[model samples]
Target: MISPVIQEEATGCGIASVANIVGKTYPEMKAIANGLGIYADDTALWSDTQYVRTLLKNEGIATSDNEIPFTTWDNLPDTALLAIKHHQEDGKDFWHWVVFKRIDGNAMVIDSAAYLDSNTRTDFGEMTPKWFIKVSLLHESSFDA
Candidate 1:
């Protein structure tokens, strides 16, 4: 089971989500991001999409980013980083990041902010999948391209 870490602050959700998936502590990932000039006090809480990929790669994780439609959820790997667009009740639209795990036909979302209940099995209620970054922990030789 993956341990969940709540985003320390409102803007750190992206970093926090990635850290939680990669099994790193919030402070540890935050420090690396801070050193790379990616994390700012509060104003710069959101990370540039590409930079998130680079950060994962620098830590030796292989990842591929792609924009996939919500209907194609079945095509997603067992575990992936999902970018979802949600329309808030107040009429504002926001993009949130979460780690997705599919098991036994049930999809689970591991959100750093606990926006989702841990190990939730329900499909996307209001959130729509926009894109995802697939992470591979195995060596390149293990899988064929």
Candidate 2:
């Protein structure tokens, strides 16, 4: 099940996304990330896949990080943590973490950084996913192998 939307603070996108997937409050997850030495208080940056994987492990969830091409977007699971890259007006690739899921037959994205106060799903058509973390049960084996 997908968790409630949690707004990101500065570089909290990665932490917030991980929190949403693990059913933790943003502050709580931030604290955990900090204790794990993955959060940078000075810069408010938290973008470490290894740390994210450890967080999932602590929650009893098995996951694997993968770089997925856009052509395989349709193969993504209904609910997932996605990393999307888009070119900003500054002529640079801007990376953002977002939650991807389908609600009522419509694909949508829950981007805390985009709309903070609101917890609504937006159209995924505008997003360009570059990477994703695949979460699954411990006892299950991936079909990819």
| Candidate 1 clash figure, as a count | 0
Query: Which candidate number has the best TM-score?
Result: 1
| Lowest-sum lDDT 10-residue window in model 1 | 40-49
Instruction: List ranges where model 2 is wrong by over 4 Å.
Output: 1-3, 40-48, 86-94, 103-106, 114-119, 143-145
**Cα lDDT for residue 83, model 2?**
71
Question: Candidate 2's residue-wise lDDT over 58-133, tens digit each?
Answer: 6666776564544565777766667776435445444667777665666666676745554445646666777676
Off by over 4 Å in 1: 40-47, 86-94, 103-106, 114-123, 141-145
**Residue-by-residue lDDT tens digits, candidate 1, 56-78:** 77677777645454556677777
Indicate the residue-level lDDT of 53 in model 1: 68
